[model samples]
Target: MNIIETNLNFGNLTKRSRTVRAILHHSAGSKASAEDIHRWHLANGWAGAGYHFLVRKDGSVYRLRPEWAVGAHASGSNSDSIGICFEGNFMTESMPTAQKQAGKELVAWVKKKYGFTKVQAHRDVQATGCPGTNFPFAEIANGSTGTVTPTPPTSGNTYTVQKGDTLTAIAKKYNTTVDALAKASGITDPNKIHVGQTIVIKGAAEKPKPTKPNGNTGTNPIIRDGQIHARNFAMPGLGADGIRGPRTKEAGIRVLQQAMNRDYGAGLALDGIWGRKSEKALGRHTVRRGEKQYMVTALQILLMLKGYYCNGVDGHFGAGCEKAVRQYQADHGLTVDGIAGYNTFKSLIQ
Candidate 1:
């Protein structure tokens, strides 16, 4: 499969630690580019576009986010999953043959690269249906298309002559001069052309440019910077100096520990270590709508880190926080009650 590199800037994104599975998704729309999605995600207050790759209907695969970075595509599974989003809503429209075939190849390539045995749909991990019910999850995940190299869009700008077509009429149809068309088609006698003759049009659509590879191996040094670490771990008020120092990471952990202490009254030391005590102290405390607490702030921060919009990490569990909680629950296979209980907290923190 031809993976097209993009120059879209995704300010700071977290690097994923491991690759255990590939998650498939649909754009839920008929037409969109990677850049369009990136803008949408930025509006939602995310790092950038959530999916790592986007497969267009014409079989063009564009790299959106870095393939190795943790994506916002899946809620609980983002840290270890690679997300591949296909263009168009499968629930309403059929996927083109070229797009489907390309998807299979991409899936196969990722599986081979990471030794991945698990390929899942959005609905499999999240509560809501996505990639839609009509998505060909089985066929793509099976990767039966084999190693056939994908054919790029055709290069020739030729037109076929119909029964009543004339050289003058053909040139007009293609918005070109008759002389230019005759020269391009190598027709010395333009008026003497017979039916079913192929005529090349001058100044028609140009050949699509070849895409460049991103040269990413998942270990790029840019993925290790402090800005990404702070954003990945959701450490608000922690300045990311662009340095990948130990203190930056530790400070993020400390923020989480402190939040738990203030909210849950877990009397453990303010150590950055997320050990068994912290886990045990995360009791079955539930926070829902119409409540304001430190736990709500922590919940909002965690939700944002996982790629959900929480309208900023304020200590208020209002409508936005409730909506984010419900989304998180739905995405993580939890009960969708819009409540951040023990199970929700455990999923977000651990």
Candidate 2:
């Protein structure tokens, strides 16, 4: 497998630290490569890249950290769990072919070496929509959400920009109008995006029904299973029914830690159970400014632009932003919704 891992050590972890389990999957929202993921960790003051290993869409694997070293990727579980970040946003889109191949191989090897019992997506632990929409959650989670298939994608689609890529060039290649591209990508300031920046691309008209599953629907709701199994030449069969079981729930809980971008499970404990802490992180807990630290990223930025504090775009959700959301809802007589619920989010979008 084409993978790279960093050797940096954090506070109490060292080469002696035994990796009990691994949490696999992608950078779901951004278009960053494995190398980019490594760089991002360094830029963010981490000891090094957070994941034990990261696979790029092109099939190149980079190791940001090793199993021996603790990762900062999954909030409360970082100390013990080794994290894996695959390139691409699988939540709302499909992943590259190469990435899918590498993911499986890596997982198999990890399972063999670590004797891991559970493997899953970020959303399995908590209530956040992460790992992206295109993730094959059932295959990875060991089951499906229900018998029902998910909603189909609409005609307008979004795409994140890649390195050495351009909007106009992509527009031309896709045979689409720049206006449609801009709107679909939700680029109010199209000119502001940078290398490795993602944008929406108007794809062929979406089908009326959910597309046939082809490895994108795994235990993680956002990150696809195809990429997760790409590590080895021989990918294991996940089974036909593809329904979620106990294993899938476990993965969601792990991902929940990352989705919430939590340092420690404030309202919850580190145990595998998904309860109040997960709910609060899912934006169900009470809101109070100067209490929550808002993490800055596209999601947080979008929330802030819509008048939520999001603590000045730092990429970590702080208490201030949570307070702002509650205050805004109360002022608007919108049920005093402390959480950034769908309705509140829609209002912010408006």
Number of the top-ranking candidate, with lDDT as the measure: 1
Error of 2 at 229 (Å): 44
Least accurate 10 contiguous residues by lDDT in model 2: 146-155
Winning model by TM-score: 1
Q: Native-vs-model 1 lDDT? A: 0.69
Clashes, model 1: 1
Q: Point out where model 1 deviates above 4 Å.
A: 148-350
How do the residues 1-350 of candidate 2 rate in per-residue lDDT, one tens digit apiece? 32332334444334425556667667864577555665677788876677777767775555566445667777766665767777777766787765665566666555544556567566665565667678654454342121221111211223445677666776665555566665544344446555544444322212211334674321222222311221111122322222233433333343333434453345444344556655566564222333434322323433432223434445444555554555455434464434555455434333
Lowest-sum lDDT 10-residue window in model 1: 148-157
Query: What is the overall TM-score of model 2 with all chains considered together?
Result: 0.37
- Cα lDDT of model 1 by residue, 159-212, tens digit: 666799998887765555788766655455678775535665423213311223
lDDT by candidate, in order shown: 0.69, 0.48
Residue 177, candidate 1: alpha-carbon lDDT: 74
